[model samples]
Target chain A: MKTIKQISVFSENRPGKLEKVTKVLADNGINIRAITIASSEKFGVIKFLVDRTQAALDLLKQQGFTVAQNEIMAIEISDEPGGLHRLADLLARKKVNIENASGFVIEASKKAVILVEAADIEQAKSELQNEGLRFLSEEEIIQ
Target chain B: MFWDKKIETISRSGLERLQLKRLKSTLAGINKNVPFYKDKLKKLKIKPDKIRNLEEIRNLPFTTREDLRANYPYGLLAVSLDHVVRLHTSSGTTGKPKAILFSRKDIEQAADLIARCLVMTGMKKNEVFQNMMSYGMFTGGLVMHYGAEKVGLLVIPAGPGNTDRQISLMQDFKSNAIHITPSFALYLADVLEKKGVDPRKDLFLKRAYMGAEPYTEATRNKIEAIYGIDVYNSYGLSEMNGPGVAFECPEKNGMHIWEDNFLVELVDPKTNGPVPEGKEGELVLTTLCREAMPIIRYRTGDLTSIIPGKCRCGRTHRRVSRMTGRTDDMFIVRGVNIFPQQIERVLMAIQGVGRNYQITLDSLDDMTVKVEIRKELFDGKVDHLVNLQNTITEKLRDEIMVRPRVELLEPGALPPSEGKAKRVLDNRTL
Candidate 1:
C-alpha cells in the first residue's frame, strides 16, 4: 500500500523558522521523513512526518509550540548529487511536477527535508516504484 | 519654421534654382564658418565651384545620431547662444535630451510652417486653436501657439492632463481645433463619456491635430467617435522642425510633404541607400533653409513610405504616409522582439486594467533579469486586483514571451509628469 507519512516540525515563530525545524529533527532519534508548510499572512502550518511521528509529536507538543502532524512523503532516495534527478526523471516521464519534497537518505543518513506538490500523486508513486526506485516509509527514518 | 532655414517649399523648377543657390551658400558657409567641414573639403580637394547642385551636396559627409548626441547642448549651435531666443528638446530615454537652440528668426519661421499645416488641416482664420500638447521647453505647445496666432486664429495654450477644464474651455470658447497626442485625446474622450458629457453634443470641437507619438487606426476611430471631430495626423521633429513636417489632407490617405520647407528622403536604414518609391524606409530630412544649427540628412527613425502618387487635394506637393511604426523602438525581451505598440494594443483590448501599467526589470538571485509588472488599477478592490493581475500576467506572458510578476495597484498611484505623460518607467538600465 502506498502510504503518506506525517512528521511534526517544531519551529520558532521568529528568526529561525526552517532552521528550528531542522535542528529539532537532528537532535532526536526520529528522522524527518517528509514535510510541507502551508503559510498564511502571519502564522504558518508546518506539516511533516517523522520515522517516530508519535514520539516526535509528543516531544514537540511538550515544548509548548503549536505542533501538528500532517501527511507527506519520505521516498527513499540514493545518496548521490543527482539521485533525485533519477527519481524526478521518472516522475517527469509520468508528467508529474514536484511542488515540494523532504526526508533523509539511509546511505549516509544525510537527513534532509523537502516540501513538494505534484499534479498526480498516485501516478508519481507508481511510476517511481515501477522504475525500481525505493521509498522510505514512516517507520524507516526514525531508528 | 524655415524663415531662418530660408526654406519655403518652392515648385520643382524653383527648387532646382534654389538648390543650386543654397548649394553654393551651404558650401561657402561650411568653408567659412565650420573648420571641420572646411578641412574635409580641403582634404577632398573640392572647392565651392566643384559643388554645383543638390547631387554634389550629397558628396558632403552625412551627419548621424552619434554626431548629434556627441555635440549636445550648445556644441552644434552654428549661431552664438545669445542670438538663440527659443529652446526645446525631446526626452531622450538613453541619456540627456538633445537641446535644440532656435534663433528668433528660427522660431518665427517654424511657427509659419506650423501655421500653414494648421490651415491645411482646415483651421479657419478666426477659429480658436486649443494647444493641448505639453508647453514650455517642448515645441508641441509653443509652436502651435505661435502658429495659430500667426494665422490670425485665437489660441488657447491649455496643454494636457486637465481634461475637465480643457473640455469646459472647448465648450465655452467654441474651440474649433485641439492639438495633442492621440493617446491623451482618447483618454479625454473616455473621461467625457463617463462624466455624462458628450463632446460633440456637450461641446464644440471641429478638428484635432495629433502627433508626438505614433498611434493605431482603432485609436483614431475612438477619438473621432467621442469628439465628433476630424482628427488629422501631423508629423514633425525638434531636429528638423517642430509640428509642421507633413499633414494628412481631409482624404486622410497620406500627409503632404512640404517640399518647399524641407527635402525628404526614404533611406533604407540598414543599407543607407535610397528606398524605391512605395517601399517603407526611414524618413531622412534635409531642411532647405535652416541657418542656425542647420541639420543635413537627419534620420527621423520613424518607419514610413514616401508615396509618390498625386493626391486629390491637387497641391502636387509629394505626400508621405502617416508613420506606420518604428524600427528603433523594437526591443528584445527574453529573446522576443517586443514593441510598446504590441503591449498597448493588448492593454487597450483588456477592459479591466487601466492604461497606467509600468514594466520594470528586477534582478533575481539566479543572475537573470525578471520582469515585474505593476498593474495600473481601474478600481480599488482586492478581489479584482488578484483576478486582473492573474489574467494580465498570463496574457502578457503569452503575448510578450516572458513571465512577469503582476502586482495590481490602486488607481492614481503611478507617478505623474507635468511635461510629458510618463508612460514608460524603466529602472533596470539605471
Candidate 2:
C-alpha cells in the first residue's frame, strides 16, 4: 500500500486568499501537482498535493499560514465513463468512508488518479490493495 | 427648582470654600482610619490640617485602579465594617473586583446627589421612572433607583434585558422617563419599531438618562428622535458614587460635576499633572463627601475636558464634557468594562491561539475578537476549528463577563503592527 503526503492550508474566504496561498508556494519554487478547496461561509481550507511535500509544508508554515500535513491515498483508475463509479462502488461496499477526494486525468497514459482522504487511510490502502487496485507512491505522484 | 438649591447654585467662592473644607476632612478621615491613605500621606510628609486651598489637592498622591485592587475588599474603607451599611463591586482588570463600601450617611448622600441630578434633568415627583440598568453588585441600578425614589417618581426597578417586557412595562405603567444605557436604548428602539409601537404616541416617556457607558451626542439625538424624548448624558463611576457624579441640566450642554460632593480635576494622563483649564485630559476625582471610603484624587481613566464658564442653567457646579476616550485600553461593551489585556490573557493561556488578535467593536456594541489560528492547530478539519473558536469564546466570556464573537483567521491575517499594535478597533461612534 502506497500513500502520498497532502498539505492543507487554512484560509479565510476573502478576496485574494488563494492568490496569497499560491504565491507562497510559487515563490518558494514548490510546484503544486493538484489543488482543491473546501470552504464554508466564513473560511476555507486549501488541500494541495505539491511536488516537494515536506518543503511546501515547511515553507507555508514558516510564512505564518495555518498548514497541516496528512497522508492521502491516490488510486489510479481507467480513464472511462465508469472508472470513478466502479471505484466508488467498491469503496462504498468495503465501508471505506472517503472524507474528501479530488482527481486529475492523464491524457498520455489514458488513466485518472483520484486522491482520497480518509480517517482510516491504512485500512483504505489495504482494502483497495486487496481488490488489486494500483496506488501511486509519493515519488510517483511527484513525477 | 433644584434638589439642593443652595448647594447646586453655590457661588464660585463659596463652592471653593466648601470643597477646601471637605477635602481637608476627607484627608483627615482617611489619614486616621485607612492605612493605605495614611501610609501614602505620611510618605509625602503632608498633614491634613496644613492643606489650605483647593490648589493643594495637586500635592496629594494619585490613586489608580491598581491601587484600589491592591487594597481589595476592606483596605480602603475609612470606617469599620459595623458602620458600613452597603457594598458594591465593579469589574477589575484581574480576577478580583474593586469593592466600594458605603456607610449609612454615604448612601443617603449618594441618593441625595442622584435626586439633585434627577431634578436637574426635569424629573418630577409624578413621573414614572423605569430603571433599566443592572442591579445587585453593579451600582447603576440601585443608585439610580434610590435617587428616583427620593424624587418621588413612580420608580420601576426593571433591570436590563428582556426588551419585550421592558417595552410592555413602559406602556403599562406609562413610564415617563428611563435610566438606560445608550446601546440598550438603541436595541429597545429597534424592538419598538419591529412591534409597530410608536414611542411618542404609544408611550409617555418625556426624557431618558443614559449613562454607565460612553456614547456620542449623535447617538443621543438619534434616540431622542426615535422616542421623541430628550436624551440626557449622565457620567459617574462607582469610586465616586455611581451615576450622579455629573449630570446635564435642561441646557443639554456639558454635564455639571456636583462640586459640593466630588472635586473634579482634569490632568494629563501621562504626566499626572493638571492640564491647562478646559483642555481634554483624564478625569481625576476625589470623594469629598463620602464617609466610609474616601478616594482622593482617584484617576478615572476617562478622557474629557471642562466646559469653561457657568452653564446657562444657573448651576455653578463646573461642567465636564462628554467623555472623548479612555486613557487606557479599557472599553465598555454592553456597559461592561473590558480590557484588551483580559482578552489577551485568555488567548495566551489557550494552546492553539496565535500571538496576534484584534478586538473589533461594532456600532451596536457587539464585540468580535478575531484571533489568529496557529499553524500547528490546523488539522484539515472544520469541526476542530469550530471547536477551537467556541472554546476561545467561552473562555473570553468567563474572563471579561461579556460574550464576544470569536473568529479564527489564518496566521498573519491580522495586520502586523510595526511597533505598538493597535489591538482594539472601536467602530462605535462613541
Candidate 3:
C-alpha cells in the first residue's frame, strides 16, 4: 500500500494564526503542494501536503506548533464531470469511508489528485488497489 | 512530632474551657478598645461577662467584610497604634480592602498557630523550607516563614515567581518542603517538564503547602503525581492571620481548625442560620486569640463544612472540609447556583485537559468554557478533538447542571498561570 504524509497543525481560530504557521514553513523553505483548512467556531486544523513532510513537521513542532503527520492516499483521476463521482462510487462500493479529503488540479481539464483520509488507511489502500486504482507515491505527489 | 502536644491533643472539654476563657477576654478587650464593637454590644445590651456558654455566641452581631471595610485603617483596632507592630490588608477585589492590624503579641500568636499547622503537616526541624507566596502585605509569606523558622526549619523565603531560580534553589539547597499556590505548582510542573528535570530525581522536595486559593482535589492529585510529593491544603485569609487558620493532618482527609484560637460555625449563606450538622455552608469564624483585632463571629464568606468524625491524628480540634468556593464566588446561571471550582473539578479530572481554563458568562447568561488542550493530546484528528470537547461539555453539564459551550484551544492560548489564577470572567449585566 502506497501512502503520502499529510502534516496537520492545530490552530486556534484567531487572527495571525495562519500567518504564524505559514511564516514558520516559509522560513524553513518547505513548499506546500496542497492545503486544506477545516475550522469550527473556536479553532481549526490546517492540513498540508508539503514537498518535505519531515522537515515541515519538525520545523512546526520546534516553533511550538501542535502538528501531526498523517498517512493519506492521493489518487489521480481525469479532470472531468465524472472524475470525483467515479472515485466516490468505487470507494462507496468498497465501504471505504473518507474521513477527510482535499484536492487540486495537476493539469486543467486533464488530471487532478484527491487526498483521501479514511478510517483504515491500509485497508482502503488495498481495497482501492484491488479495484485497479493507482495511488500517487510520495515522490510523485511532491513532483 | 507535635509543636504543642498538650494543646494539640487536648480533650474536648478542656479545649472548650480554654476557648471560652479566651473568648471572654477577646470580647472584653474589643469592648473596651474598639468603639465599633462597644457600640454594637451596647445596642444589644449584651454584657461580655454574661456570655457564659459558647452557644450564646449566636447572639453576637456578625462582623462582615463590609463592616471590616467600614472600620478600615484602625477604626476597629482593639489596641493602640503604639502596640501594633504589623498590618496586613486583604486582597479586596471588589471595593476597599480591609485593614488588619497586629500587635507584637498578636504577631507571635499567629506565628505559633502557624507553627502548629506546619508541625501537624509532618514538617520537621532542619528541613529546608522554600516559601513561594508573596511577602509584604500578604500574610501568607511572612506568617508561614515565621512558623517554619519556629519549627527550626531553614526558611528560604523565596517569595513566588522566578521559576528558573526556584528550580535551581531547590536543586542546590536540597529544599524538602515548599509553600505555594496550586496554580503556581501546575506552572512549575510545566517548567520542570520543559527543562527535562524530573522532580523525584533532580530535586529533594518532599511536601508542598498549597493555599491562598481554592483548588479542587483533582488538581491536588495532578500536582502530587507530577512532583511525587504530598500536597497539603492550608486555608487562611489575611483577615484571620493568613495561611494558618486551618491545615490538613498527614491523613489528608480534612483540615483541623485550631479550636483554641478560633470558634468555627457553618451557616447557610442565604439565611445566616446554622446549617445542619456536617452540611456545607458559609464558614463563620470568631477569633479567640487575636490581640490587636479580635473579630467576633466574623463571616469569612468562605464555603465549607465541618467533618463529622474526628481525624486519625487524634487532634481535639475539629476538621473542616476543603473550601468548595466562596459565597461571593458563586454565580447563578439559569437560576442554578454554580461555582467556578466545579468546572475546574470536571476539567482537571479529564485525561487530556491542561491546567488553565476560564469560564465566561455573557450578558445573555449563557456560559462558555475555554479549555486549553494539552499539546501532546493534539493528534491532528479533528474528530478526536471534537470528541474531547463533547466529553468536556457533557462532564461539565453533569457537574454544573447547565450545559456550557466548550471551546478547545491550543496550549498557551489562554493567559499564562501566575499569582492567584482568576478562573471566572462574569460579563452578566445583572
Off by over 4 Å in 3: none
Order of models, best DockQ first: 3, 2, 1
Task: Output the lDDT of residue B350, model 1.
Answer: 62
Number of backbone clashes in candidate 1: 24
> B1-430 in candidate 3: lDDT tens per residue?
5899999999999998898999899999999988999999999999999888998898999999999999888898887779889989986678888999999888888899999988888888878999999999989899998888888899998998899999999999999999999988988888888889999889898999999889999999999989999999999998988889999999999999988999999888888888875899999999998988889898998999899877789887999999999878888888889988899899998988998898899955589999989988777778888889999999999998999999988777787666688888988777
Candidate 1 segments whose C-alpha is farther than 4 A from its true place: A1-143, B1-13, B39-49, B80-83, B326-328, B345-419
lDDT by residue (B1-430, candidate 2, tens digit) is 6888988888999999999999999999999999998999999999999987899899999999988888998999888789999999988445678999999999999999999999988888888999999999889999999988989989999998878889899999999999998767865775686588999999999999998866667667778988999999999988888888999989999999988888888999878878876899999999899999999999999889999987888899999998876656678998887876677667767878765688999955699999888776678976667778889989999988888988888766777542224678988885
Model 2 pairs in collision = none
lDDT, residue B11, model 2 = 93
Q: Measured against the native two-chain assembly using Cα atoms, what DockQ does each of the candidate structures obtain, in the order listed?
A: 0.02, 0.38, 0.73
TM-score of each: 0.64, 0.61, 0.97
lDDT of 1: 0.65
Candidate 1: tens digits of C-alpha lDDT, residues B141-203? 887788889988999989888887988898899888888887677567656755789788877
The runs of at least 3 residues in candidate 2 whose Cα sits more than 4 Å from the true structure, single-residue gaps closed, are A1-143, B329-430
lDDT of each: 0.65, 0.85, 0.89
Cα displacement (angstroms), candidate 1, residue B201, comes to 0.9
